[model samples]
Target: MPRLADKRRAILRGALTVFAREGYTRASIDQIAREAGVSTRTIYNHVADKSALFETVIQESAARVAEAQVEAMDRHLGGAVPDLREALVAFARDHARPTDADHFALVRQIQAEVGHIPEAALDSWQDTGPRRVQRAVEAHLARFMAEGRLRTADPHRAARHLVLLAAGEVTSRSFHGALPLPAKEVDAIVEDGVEVFLRAYAP
Candidate 1:
């Protein structure tokens, strides 16, 4: 059972790389098998088909991205910060950054293939990824509101506001992560975002 689980994980990792590079239409089981260092028959033993594999990959990758985002929120917002602005800037920086090179590649791949992929796959990704991140941010904002650190009538709205303020310009200027912004530039954007958020939500 352990060996089977390890092979499945290996196949998923390799599939991510191939799918990211070649995209859904071009990605082949044989290529994924080679990338995984497993036989094509072995891959077939794990997943029923390419579509199944792709869906699983999307879900797994989304979970990983969501985990990283939630962790960032907890790190910057869960605990006490001497300076809210500075802490928020740090959070924004982390939020904007990709979890890793492979994760970045998978994100780009998803964007590239979004129009081509199944609606179910897209929904799965959104449910596991962005929605989860939004919930985490909302929970953090609710905590701040309860503590009287922020004056928010609606914690959900405030969370959305903060996320948009922090991410909008950076995402646009970065071309949705296609272009990498330098650390200093990211910090500047986050600083401005935090200022705007404070103007709206601070007590």
Candidate 2:
């Protein structure tokens, strides 16, 4: 028999892959068990049920993604995201590498499944990944404008554009299964995007 710790780790990794690919509803404990090369009894020993296992995967992935995004922003700033284009580029490029697929895909599945489970969706959204960068960007822009680094008349308008710039490509890909994008090509896009953005908001 596998050690308790080994079995648990196996379950975790297996669940992550299944969630990211098959989604929450379709991802079964049996499938996860098969993927882990363990038995269903092993998964149940670690997590009470499929829902519990789903939450566990989401929480772990969200924490990692949030940490990386926060760290990228922190490196760009002493403590705050002050400039518009710089912050947009930082957010996009950092998150664009696509870490924590299980957590992200699980959150997406949970949100879609929430309508079917009234009481459970509340906890699901509260615990899972969120589209929080929009509000964070708005707050940062407002602060910089207040201090005069930027001269934007509408922080909201700026926030919309920033979100589009950061997430548009990845969002499109998620729907269409990743398009043809190489690393150098992506970098070129980001570079030109920054120039265009600066021109639109330059002082």
Candidate 3:
């Protein structure tokens, strides 16, 4: 038998895929349970309701993306880049891959369905929502600032721009129904962005 925690994780992952392919209003717990390979009762035992499960899945996804992004950002910090542009190339290339890109899709899904959810769901969604991803970027940038690799006057504000330049652009592309840009193109964008950012923000 699978461990309860492991089973719950499976269910959450399955539910997230379904929720992304569908939406909160249309997604069914029965489908989620089926995808999770657990009975409906088991899903309920693990989560309060569909909304609760959605919140959990979304937060978990956010956490996953945060870890990867923070790690990738650190790679640029320690390397001997000729200038900010080279450092940014690595930064953008790191995110250009398809790994866990679904989390961002989940973020878009939440924005689409937030109004339909209850106050509790809304609160959970907002607190650990895509907003936390922004905070994570801030924390990572602050680390670079502490190491003297970055010269931002305010890490928090600067992080907001970085997040917008990176993830925000990808998120915006969805609005236009455009496919994800190539990884190399993303690197160029980041390289250019870093150049511009350094003009005003870097020390």
Candidate 4:
């Protein structure tokens, strides 16, 4: 069972690499099999087809990204801070930064193939990734509201505003992770966004 689990993980990792390198339409199961160092039969045994594999990869990758973002929120907002603005800027910086090469590549692939992928897969990605990240941020903001550190009637809306303000411009300029932004530029963007967020929400 352990060996089987390891093989499945390897296949998933390999599939992600292939899918990211070659968008879903061009990625082949044989390529994934070679990258995984497993047989095509093993790949088939785990997933029904390429579509299913793609769905699995997106779901898994999205979960990871959501987890990372939530962790960033917690790290910066989980405890008391003497300077809310600074802490928020820190969180914004971390949140906007790319998680990993594979993750970034996968994001690029999603943007490239958004029209070609199944609707269900896109929905799943949204639920697992963006929505989950937003909810996590909302929960953190709600804690601040309860503590009287921030003033927002709607935590969800505030969360969305903060996220948009922090990521909107940088992400657009980066072309959804296809282009990398310089560290100094990302810091400037996050700091500016957090400043705007504080203007509206700070207590």
Candidate 5:
């Protein structure tokens, strides 16, 4: 018999697939159960309702992605950055694309169904994922400012700008990773973005 935790994970993964493919408006518990290889009754045993399930799936998925992003931030900016531009470029490249294809598919679905999604779910997603990653970058940027590697500026704003400039172009151009861009193109975008960021925040 599968462990309870394994069943729960299977349910979430199956729910994510359905939600990503069908959006919240069209996904059904029956469909999720089929995808998850579980009985409908089993899903009900775990979640109160569809709304609760969606909330849980998105928050869990976001946390997984954010964990990777925070690690990328630390890898790129956690130590002495001899070349800020190079460091930013590397970080941006590392994070420029979706590491988890299924998660981004859900993200695309969320964007499409934002108007219909529960407010709490959306808020939880942001807090669990993007905001957490932003805070990590903000902390690193603050340290850079203190080190005089970057000109003194609003760390929060600088972090936002850095993310937008560094990774936004690729994400936007790729349509949230639905369309893949070439490596050279991705590198070009990251390089240009890092250059623009360095110019804006030069000491």
Candidate 6:
């Protein structure tokens, strides 16, 4: 027999697919149950209601993405960055391209129907994902400032600047990965963004 945890995982996965396709207002428990290959009662046993299930799905997905981003930051920016601009460019390019398409699809769904989503769920998603990644970037910027690589300023603001200049640009152009961008265009965006960031922050 499948473990309860396994069933819950299946339900979450199925819910993500349905939500991404149907949005919060239209997604039905029956559809989610079918996608999950479980009974509607099984879903009820796992979660209290649709809102709770949506909250769990988004938070879990955000955490998974945040963990990967933190690891990427550690690998690219956490250690000895001999060339700051080069390192930033590399990191920006990596960050712009996420391996998980389904998660971003859900993000699009959220964006399309933001008003309908629960405020608490949005807060949890931001706390679990974007804010955590931003904090990681802020810590790295703080270290760079202490080392005299960047000008002395607010690490928080610097982190935001770097993110906006680099991956933020690419994400805007690519529509959060819904539209595929060519490697050359991506590289150009990263390079230009790093250059602009360095112009402002370089000591």
Alpha-carbon shift of residue 4 in model 3 (angstroms): 2.3
Task: TM-score each candidate.
Answer: 0.91, 0.69, 0.78, 0.92, 0.97, 0.97
The digit string of per-residue lDDT tens for model 4 on 1-203 reads: 99999999999999999998998899999999999999999999999999999989989999988898888888888877777787788888787777577877887888887899988888998999989988888888898888888995699999889978987778778866568798899988998898899889977
**Residue 105 lDDT (model 3):** 63
Write one digit per residue (lDDT tens) for candidate 5, span 41-92: 9999999999999999999999999999889879988877888888899999
lDDT of 2 by residue, 1-203 (tens): 46887888888889888977787767899999999999998788788898788777766666566666666655654365545566657666665555555566665665566664335534544544344444455666676667676666587777566545655565555532234367665555665665665566655
For 1-203, candidate 1 gives per-residue lDDT tens digits of 99999999999999999988888888999999999999999999989999889889988988988898898778988878777777788788888766566656676777876788878877887899889999898888888888888885798888888878987778777755768789788888878888999999988
Q: Between the candidate structures 4 and 5, which one is better when assessed by lDDT?
A: 5
Candidate number that wins on lDDT, 3 or 5: 5
Clashing pairs in 1: none
In order, what lDDT does every prediction score?
A: 0.84, 0.65, 0.69, 0.87, 0.92, 0.90
Q: Name the lDDT of candidate 3.
A: 0.69
Encode model 3's per-residue lDDT on 36-82: one tens digit a residue: 88899999888888878987887777667666766776677544545
Ranking by lDDT: 5, 6, 4, 1, 3, 2
True lDDT of residue 125, candidate 6: 94
Which candidate number has the best lDDT?
A: 5
The residue ranges of model 3 lying beyond 4 angstroms of the native Cα positions read: 78-82, 96-98, 119-133, 139-152, 174-178
- Segments in model 5 whose C-alpha atoms lie over 4 Å from true places: none
Off by over 4 Å in 1: 175-178
Give the alpha carbon lDDT tens digit for every residue of 1-203 in model 6: 57998999999999999998898889999999999999999999989999999999999999999999899888999878898877888788888886778888888889899999999989999999999999999999899999999999999999998888888877877778989799898888888888999999989
**For residue 145, what is the lDDT in candidate 3?**
75
lDDT, model 5, position 155: 92
